[model samples]
Target: MFLMMGLMYFVVDLAAILLLSACWQRTRIRGFAIVAASYGAGIVARWTAPLAYRWADSGDGGMGSLAGVVVQTAFFLVAVVAVVGFWDIYRVLKQRPAA
Candidate 1:
């Protein structure tokens, strides 16, 4: 179940990275590129969470829980960065001169 959920998130994150990369390439917006990279990191962190959970349930015990916490914290931080990047992109777009 957790694995399936992680896979879903991975797919969504992959798509987001691709779209943001394309947007960045077209617009040359640093924020979009940063957000896309953050999303890439997010995919890794997100995938780690469930595996850590599974390990915690098995025998890894405290270490597994700690790993899970660390990964989740990283995921949250990446999400925050992505939000800030989006805000920067929005500001840039708003400041653009009309064509």
Candidate 2:
């Protein structure tokens, strides 16, 4: 199950990069930037979001309620950014520039 989930995530990441390529073609972006943004930043940040939630409620080593609030906020921001990033990529991919 875990392996399948990981594979799905990889598929999502690649699809994001592939889709972004369409828009970047207009602005003249390097291929590496799309791959880096999609796989490195977008996917990695989305994965790390849950980790922040986990850290917010760890054992004694974890911080108090205030820290919990902060970490949860981080989690929310990361998630929001990830979603927005994907949405932006999707929007860009759908555009049809002049020939």
Candidate 3:
């Protein structure tokens, strides 16, 4: 259960990596960097989860604190940006002739 929950956190980053890989030429290093940052954000957020739960109740009140909120916000924002960029790149790659 614990391992499964932990894996769930990286779903976005993993998908972004795979998608960016598919459109490698279109995204290049920038896409990879974005995904890597997102992944890093997730790692930080998870690392801070203990403090978040301890302060923010570890109850039901969103299960987070200020630190948790900041880290989680960063993670979500970067992950979303990476995924969107990858999707757009993939679309462009599919439209053009394969290089």
Candidate 4:
């Protein structure tokens, strides 16, 4: 079951990336890496979201509220964006015209 879930996540993530790429202009490899990382993080968070909710009320760690899930998701998105944006900028710089 766990393996199936992992495979599904990978497939869904890859499909999403491919769909996005169809409308966007970027290197396939870079897009794949960014999307894969982001999707993996999302999958992990979603898989653990329920646990987060359950533990949030445990009143022990810093994640002592349902808000933890939201925070985690936001953090994951930010990380993905940062990585993708940095790579895009690098690509742009690398393609700059010679002075």
Candidate 5:
């Protein structure tokens, strides 16, 4: 069961990486920097999510639980995607030639 879960996580992560890379080129961002920056920010957010849960839980039963970690990771991923995706679309439009 653990193996399957790990596999699923790997597959999903791979898909996300591909999606981000493919989408990066079309942006006026001009370099891989934005992708790297966004990914780094996401990682930091995920790492910090436990603190969020702890605060919400009033200092008890923090993200010490498996479910909490998963929730935090998912939230971080979504937030990163939203912020980065929006910037990417904006960049794409800016880079497009006048028509």
Candidate 6:
């Protein structure tokens, strides 16, 4: 069940990335590009951190190790960037004149 959920999350993330990329290209919107790139980075980090944790667990005999710390830090930073990108998008929309 967890595996299926993970697969679904990856699919959805990929779809979002593609859609955002298209939006960025079509509209030439910086916020869209920033959000899409941040998401792409976050996806890579999301997939990589687990493997790093597993490797560290095998060697260190626990999750409380450097890998876990790095992963957590990366996740936090990525989340911050994602939020900022979203905020920028909101700002852009709010500033635009409605047609």
Cα TM-score per model: 0.73, 0.44, 0.46, 0.45, 0.40, 0.79
**lDDT value for model 4:** 0.64
Per-residue lDDT of candidate 3, residues 72-99 (tens digit): 6766786697696566656656777877
State which candidate has the highest TM-score: 6
Task: Decide which is better by lDDT, 1 or 6.
Answer: 1
Model 2 error, position 91 (Å): 12
Model 2, 1-99: lDDT tens digits are 976897798787778667666656665544434444645555665566567667766857555576667656765665565566656555655674747
List, residue by residue over 3-75, the lDDT tens digit for candidate 1. 7987888889899999999999999988999899899888777666667777777874667768767777888
Candidate 6 stretches with Cα past 4 Å from truth are 61-63
Per-candidate alpha-carbon RMSD to the true structure: 2.8, 5.6, 5.6, 6.7, 6.3, 2.1
Where is model 5 more than 4 Å wrong at Cα? 23-74
Q: Name the TM-score of candidate 4.
A: 0.45
Residue-pair clashes per prediction, in order, are 0, 0, 0, 0, 0, 0
lDDT (10s digit) by residue, model 4, range 1-99 = 977986787688668656555534554445445555565566666667666677676766666644675867676675777478458756866787757
lDDT minimum window of 10 residues, candidate 2: 29-38
Clashing pairs in 3: none
Question: Tens-digit lDDT track for model 6 on 1-99?
Answer: 977887887898889889988997887767787888778888899788879877887775765577878998998988888788788888888888998
Preferred candidate (TM-score higher): 3 or 6: 6
Task: Give residue 78's error in model 4 in angstroms.
Answer: 5.3
- What residue runs in model 1 are displaced by over 4 Å at the alpha carbon? 54-68
lDDT score for candidate 5 against the true structure: 0.60
